[model samples]
Target chain A: MAQTSTLDRGGATPSAPARRPTAPRRSRGLPAWAVPYALLLPGLLVIGGLLLYPLYQMVEMSFYKVGLRQIRPNPRPAEFLGAGNYTEVFRSELFWSSLRNTVVFAAVTVALTLLAGTLVGLLLHRLGRAMSTFVVVGIMAAWATPPTATAVIWKWLFDADAGVVNWALGLLPGPLSELIFGTSDWSGRPWLNSPATIYLVLVVAVVWASFPFIAVSVLAGLKSIPSELYEAARVDGSGPVTTFWKITFPLLRPVFSVLLVLSVIWDFKVFTQLYVLAGGTTNREAFNLSLWAYTEAFSAPPKMGFGAAIAVVLTLILLVITGVYVRQIVRTEDVR
Target chain B: MEHVSRVLTRGIAGHSVWRYLLNSAVVALGTVLAGSVVALLAATAVARFRFRFRTTFLILLLIVQMIPAEALLIPLFLMVRRLGLYDQLLGLVVVNVGFTLPFAIWMLRTFVAAVPKELEEAAAIDGAGRLVTFWRVLFPLVAPGLVATSIFSFITAWNEFVFALTLINDQGGYTMPVALGFFTSQRSTDWGGIMAASTLMTIPVIVFFLLVQRRMVSGLVAGAVKG
Candidate 1:
């Protein structure tokens, strides 16, 4: 490193000019063209081994007969089951119900998240900077909290005996509470026990966590829209609702699409919140695809093959939904 | 609110919530430390250089971002166990890095690109070598963007649950989010303790948000609007 030492000694001089690379310096050690690959090496290896390889294995495992006996010590080799796992997965009633639950949960949550997120986004856009910042920070707290933490918070909020929701309901006039929800008894309502009510709570938690992203995205989109458009609408004496439908919605269509596809993918695979809320695999009927797959593979006498099948199905569904969205994105990118 | 301070004075599953806090800190910080370096190097490369697979690389990062981490749960757990990293905080860090690295690199590239190329040439013209030039000139310029990416990694790793649950079987190794899961069961629920633990888990993220809130909004909007 004489060259290095010389450079250092030279660099110690405050007036030294930074050395410029010429022909000889360009030929040193690694070629310039290989530098990018070198930079990408570590990240690619970690992701490939951990993400891509495991994904391939997951799909492969779906085609095998992978029970506990095949996995533990003194293990027997796994036998290839071809479409056997798929047949079983398709035939199982629980699988259908879980799939149904996944679809319904996704549909409802996506709609709610977009609707609420857009409203919040518009509110944030329309408000004074100080008020917007205040609300954005408030919403950011919910968004930044860990998913499991959000679940815990909401679970407490809906607690049957001590929950604020029930407590507030109790404060409402007794006959009104009875006539509206058909339950005057707000305390000890067992909100998490039933599937329908649990989904209601789940929707709240998912929407609460999700809306901030959409809000921020839409706000950003709104910020990008020219003031001229709004001024033009004002000049035409357009009403606020008409202006939103004619200008805002059409302009934000791409952002909405991205948000919709993402929300669908996220909501369909929801696991931790449901798992925490349900307390385990005990509530079979409340299962979403992700949790259902986890239980199928990792529950006692783990049926890994069947679990893989469920995952395969889940991945395929997501791929199809994401496919259409990606095509839209790609086409737009091409146009740009 | 009471539960937050209550946790400060109580333990859960035979360990203080402080232990889980320590575990989460290890994972979060470790992920940020390792994830940011790799991502920064890659981002600098992708941002400055015209490489053969440049567009493909950027697109791959977006595709990876889209893949649901949950779909890989069973397999990632198996990989961690096979590596003999199960029930370990290091495993959590590694997985977090892998998942978050693409996003970090992708975001940081925008920041790196925004830095003028002439600055690098000027640094070279000033006697600084490759690494020093980067540290002296590029690093400070990109620090705001790097901070944004670091926060993202910290939050993602800190709050991650499913991997923590499956990877760390032992109670002692559990992250706070996983521990929060244990507070509820079919037989009984510890609402107070759970609330306390969850609140504790959320504090660092909120504090972090306040620190970087303004830059993060502008950085995200600038990069994503055209996108």
Candidate 2:
């Protein structure tokens, strides 16, 4: 969001110098144009060698047969398989299950996270300054907790025998608990056992860890709207729901779109929390694409090429989804 | 309360958490320093200079940011092994820097752009050399942004789980997140130990986040929304 409007207001005095083609680059024995290149070289080298090059290598590896032996210290060359791994992945039921798990988990988690986050954001906006700060700090504690830590905390809380969740549930009246959970005895009921339940825990943990960011972002967007619009709506006897839908939602569309896309991308890439909750990829039923890829590539008797294919597929799906956002960013940059 | 302290102590002593803490600190600090310098230079270039491929570079950063880091794990693992950085803390530092650079550069560009060109020109006219002017005028002006970006890098590197989990095979090399991961995966799960270790790992990030929450919320939203 490098809006030059802000910059123009801040530096209105000497803005002309910024646009000059021959701006002062008297930074020693370097040519003017070479200065920028020199400044960019180290960053380019790191991103090129690590990010871009590895992306290329991943695509390349997807078409090969790579394993632990081929990746050893004194490595043997990987045999080229020419899309064999992709075909095999397509043929496997595990791949389809993992894909389903990934998509379903992302869909549920994104919806819940946004809904909770937007409500919290609205509350924060309505509160007094000190109250908002107090609430925000509490939320930040949740938001800033590492994913590993979040999973661990949630896992312990939902432990079969000693978990606070089951204990609290058991304290509820029998018929009410049964009505809600289909049983009064949540005692010793394992929340992380099946694919469905593991995803349930994963959703709670992820939504807890993620919603703060969305809340903060939404709050910021809400703060940017002019209060006069709300006052006028109130004068017209608009209900809170009507006002929000008509004014707030339309005004914050850009922020909402960005947050929606980011949440999808993040939920799609959920790895650490799932890995921990599903107990290190042992539970095949709970495996999302990330866990599936890691298990295939890094576990014993590793099929690195097969894993690469899964990862490539995941990347392509993400790229296609986020391509519009990237184009929008580029257009915004052009505007600036 | 007393039992909690004892459990926390046992968790720390039993798992060699001090070692992991030291590892996380080293990796996070390294990432902050290296990521800041590299990102600052690039941000300055993008903000100040109208260079060729400038728009392309900006677009590339966006695209790179969109790709999940987990997807690159397979090839990066091989590349790290080939580069002889496998299983090393420095390797994690390098990876974290690579991951954090794009956002850091994007955030810092606004800061650099906000600093008026006139101040630098005045410094130059007053016989301040390029390096001198940058250090004196530009760097101080961008220090708040630097702090924000550094904190971001610190949190990212400190909390990084996937890369640390796959890359480091040795127990001694395990960072805090990886170390906490072991408590969950073990057959006889120690809930107290896990909770204590999780608290230990989470405290620093929460503290840092509270210290800068006001600036960070606006900065993050502005950076994301405006871009």
Runs in model 2 with CA error above 4 Å? A1-28, A176-184, A332-336, B1-15
Model 1 agreement with the true structure over B88-148: per-residue lDDT tens digits: 9988998888898877887788899889887876565465556677799999999989999
What's the C-alpha lDDT at position A315 in model 2?
94
Per-structure clash totals for the candidates: 5, 2
**Candidate with best TM-score:** 2
How would you encode candidate 2's per-residue C-alpha lDDT over A1-336 as one tens digit per residue?
A: 121233334433463554332223342357656878999999899889879999999999999999988988778898999989999999999999999999999999999999999999999999999999999889977988899999988888888887999899778678886677787655788898999989999999999999998988888889889999999999999999999999999988777877888889889989999998888878998888888998999989999999999999999999987887876665545513
- The DockQ scores of all candidates, in the order shown, are 0.49, 0.53
lDDT of 1 by residue, A1-336 (tens): 212334445445556433433323534646656777888898888778877888899999899998988766678989999999999988999888988888998899999999999999999998999999999888977888888888877888888887889888777677876776787655677788988888889999999998888898898889889999999999999999999999999988887777787788789888888987776888998998888888888889788888988888988888888776666566555311
lDDT of 1 at B164: 86
User: Which whole-number lDDT from 0 to 100 does residue A283 have in model 2?
Assistant: 91
Best by lDDT: 2
- Measured by DockQ, the strongest candidate is 2
Per-candidate fnat, comma-separated:
0.51, 0.65
Find the 10 residues in a row with the least total lDDT in model 1 chain A.
Answer: A1-10
DockQ of predicted model 1: 0.49
